[model samples]
Target: MACENMKRVQKEAINNWRDHLKRKLTGQSVGTKDWLSSIKQQQDFSRDDSIPPLTAPDGSVVTSHRGKAQVLAAHFSSKMTVPDPEREPPTVPVLTKASLGNITITTEEVLQQLQQAPAAGIASWGKRWQVTLAPDKIQAILISRRQDAVNWDQHAILLEGRKIHLQESVNILGVEFDSGLTYTSHVRKVAKDAAWKLSCIRLVAHLLDAQGFGTLYKSQVRYLMEYSPSHGPPAPVIPPPP
Candidate 1:
């Protein structure tokens, strides 16, 4: 669950940074972006504030706060750092549009080195699942988006083994709904939360892009990056049959 933890920590840092910026913009002096650099260091989030914050006219208190925010943004821009692009590129070739519709291709091997032995912990309710390996060790696990069809629309990855299960049971006549019943997978026990799966998938796709296994067109990445956790933190994991 390292990725999940990372996301949690990253989200907290981002919110704190945003709060810092808000405080600065609202006529408060927030230390430089690096002053609270501890947040950035804790998570692998990109801290590039390239576009300066819009400022109010000079001398106005609100404007002054906005101006300070701009200053912080500028400082953030100056501190921008990314892996040297010129350094040796990843060895894996990127998947093209022709490969996009294919559901068979996965970049699991890229994270094969990351997979470690299972951990010794037991499931919360005496369930059959055991948390395996190092924290965040599971880079990917296949989940069926659809059981009958192998379309890309029905397949998803449990990047950190988080699943969403509907809490309240609904009765439809004589049939009982058992969470995500409509979204059945060949492999059952998938996370029912759409946002969580999307988050994991988005991050997995990002990691793949970073490794040259796949590409994310800019607009798509922008949209996905803007996805917020409206429901809640990712759901806990449920084990599948061994």
Candidate 2:
């Protein structure tokens, strides 16, 4: 009788757990324990591998996992070190207003300042923590409405004595930006990706009910659509005319 009672209790507990999960997935509030467990599961699902191998200062690639970790540690350590306030500031060429009313600095001065920046930042961290800025990864983009007026081929920015190549478009973070500064390309790409994800969800629609599908759509599809760059102010919304 005791064995039968225990089996009955176990079945009831399993049914209760399933009911709780269903409620939680359907936008209903769950217990603190359940909520925390769900968050942990999501975190585990989203966790990815460590940083990939990067090119060292001498141009040789650090392919080993340990080498990549060390590179990242040194780079971050240099960046995080506090600068000494008592230390004399590095001399940099001051920008002045030109005859055309635009503020300008000499190209030579700009190059000099760029060269000094890395050394100044890492000075506090010492030689062991020094990080080399990758020249090939550096991108320069001119933000001008007149594409024809801007001669990209003729102009180049030098960093660490190497000429930084100009690109028509570059992906900053996850968003794609072009010389024109239009979000059209980014929007199109995100839409295509979202469509693909939606197709995948549709394939498994038979296994999920409306609530489960809605939850999945919000977490995966809606997130992509809402993502925006943090650097700039958001676009203002225009109200309809009464």
Candidate 3:
């Protein structure tokens, strides 16, 4: 009977040690994940491709992979080309002090003038390559302090003879800018998106150890919040589960 009691005590001691080790490892894993997530939020600048494909100049939607690539290539090529020194530079209208004082300038008029100013340069470039600008893909945002200052309904910008309506917000690169220049909307959007992504990550948490989970969080959730071109509100902090 004494032998059996001694064996039982030994088994209990082993089980306790195993449990203690498991708990310690789990704590370490959690700490590592937290650290990785933090590092990712600071450094990651990756963003998902959510923007719609550009429409070609022919008025047909560029849906195919090759067509989309070609459109992007053409657009970027035109922007990157150097102006020829021998070629006469395109004339741009200069806004003089006298013109500004004499004219009863509304926001719409300013927008129109600015829109028209770029036409000469674009036309000169298009003449060389025989490539026309895609009006549908061009977007405009009117930045103003007053909410009613921009006449969105009345104001329309023309590019290559096609009229394009103004947008309340525009995403240039990965950053989003609204008409008011406030980043509240952008911050809210990033937070909501990160929350959704975290929920998805939770499903696969078992598949990944702490290190793996941390890496995933950095690449996906943290990246969305960190990459911004303009100064805005801080990203919403979401603490990891204890």
- Candidate No. with top lDDT: 3
Reference-based lDDT, each prediction: 0.40, 0.64, 0.66
| lDDT tens readout by residue for model 1, 10-118 | 9998887776544433431222453344344444334553333344345433224456676667657757866576799769876765654555635454224223222
In model 2, the clashing pairs are: none
Per-prediction CA RMSD (Å): 23.6, 19.9, 21.0
Tens-place lDDT per residue, model 3, 1-242, is: 99999999999987876665445444422344444443344344122322345699888887556787899898899899877858987898876755433647576567667677675567678879998677665667767666775466465566666676778887776577788887777777778887999999999999998877876786677656554343333233233443
Candidate that scores best on TM-score:
3
Off by over 4 Å in 3: 1-115, 128-131, 228-242
Error of 1 at 217 (Å): 45
Q: Please give, for residues 88-159, the per-residue lDDT of candidate 2 as tens digits.
A: 878987697554757776656645664476544544454457756665656666666656744555654555
- What residue runs in model 2 are displaced by over 4 Å at the alpha carbon? 1-129, 228-242
Tell me the TM-score of each prediction against the true structure. Answer: 0.17, 0.40, 0.46
Ranking according to TM-score, highest score first: 3, 2, 1
